[model samples]
Target: MTPMIDVVFLLIIFFLVSSHLSRRENRMPVSLADSATGISETSPADDVFTLTMDAQARLFLNGSQLSTDVFSSRLPRDSTQTVRIRVDRSLAYEHLNRVLATLTDRGFQNVSIVTSPIAVSRP
Candidate 1:
């Protein structure tokens, strides 16, 4: 009876600590760009087009804000450009999907999501 009671108490404490840890992660900015096996290529400046999205689902292309209509126009119609898209985890999936659909329509087949490798934080 004593061993069973101790195990139950230990489990309760473990749950309490783990719950707090998860909440802490939520308090920070949510970014989906965390990857372990990301491509390690140093692409030429001219060949890479980076698309960034904020938590509010706002899209920016190379630091310039453009509407979806204008975005489609800016992309080269004939060139098969490799675009790297970095999206915040908090942003809506629909926003990213919309941009992907547009890119596919424009014949840009090589699209990659940019992400950072997850590393252990040592305190």
Candidate 2:
């Protein structure tokens, strides 16, 4: 009887550890785009792939910096995959155009540019 209880305890510990590891492996963060208008009353969907660009032209995926080669390799090859690009307002047009071209070449036809909602200031 004691042996059976010990086995159950071990199984529980194993499952808990495995779950923790799985959750830690997926750390991608979704970035929201800026908009001149206010946020909608309804909440947006949580599932999305986000790409970020910084003022210095640094590129990131879910907050993790990635080179052009690395980014291209990691992109989903599926033609149906939806991609959202979040570029810093300070970034140059040339850089943004390059990224868009890369996505198009990689077969990601459905893509959206994200932006922040406009903030209303009280006079």
Candidate 3:
């Protein structure tokens, strides 16, 4: 009985630490662009892949900076995989377009640009 209880406690601690670490990937320092009509809801599906672009137009995959070639190589062969791109608001359109073009050229059909909801102005 004592050994069983210790194993359960260890498992619980492992899960808690892993969950916290997993969330750290999405907390990169990119300031997302704002959209008045953007849907702010996010899917909880594990199949979703995220790519982030910082203000300097540097691309990151899984919180690690990667070049376009490496990024393409790392993409799943399933063109239908859902991809979410989060770009800094200050980045130029050309930078965004380049990423879009790469995805489109590779036959990715389920891609989305992530943006924050615009703050409402209160009088």
What CA RMSD would you report for each candidate?
17.3, 6.2, 2.4
Compose the digit string of candidate 1's lDDT tens values, residues 1-123.
999999999999998987775344233343776675766747754576667777887777656577888888888665577787778976778999998999888788889886778875678
Task: Compare the candidates by TM-score and give the number of the best one.
Answer: 3
Q: What's the TM-score of each model vs. the native?
A: 0.66, 0.61, 0.83
Instruction: Supply the global lDDT for candidate 2.
Output: 0.71
Superior candidate under TM-score, 2 versus 3:
3
lDDT of 3 by residue, 17-119 (tens): 8888667668888888778786654666467888999999899887899998898898889998899988998999999899999999999998998887877
**Candidate 2 off by > 4 Å:** 1-34, 37-47, 119-123
What TM-score number comes out for model 1?
A: 0.66
Candidate that would win on lDDT: 3
What pairs collide in candidate 1? none
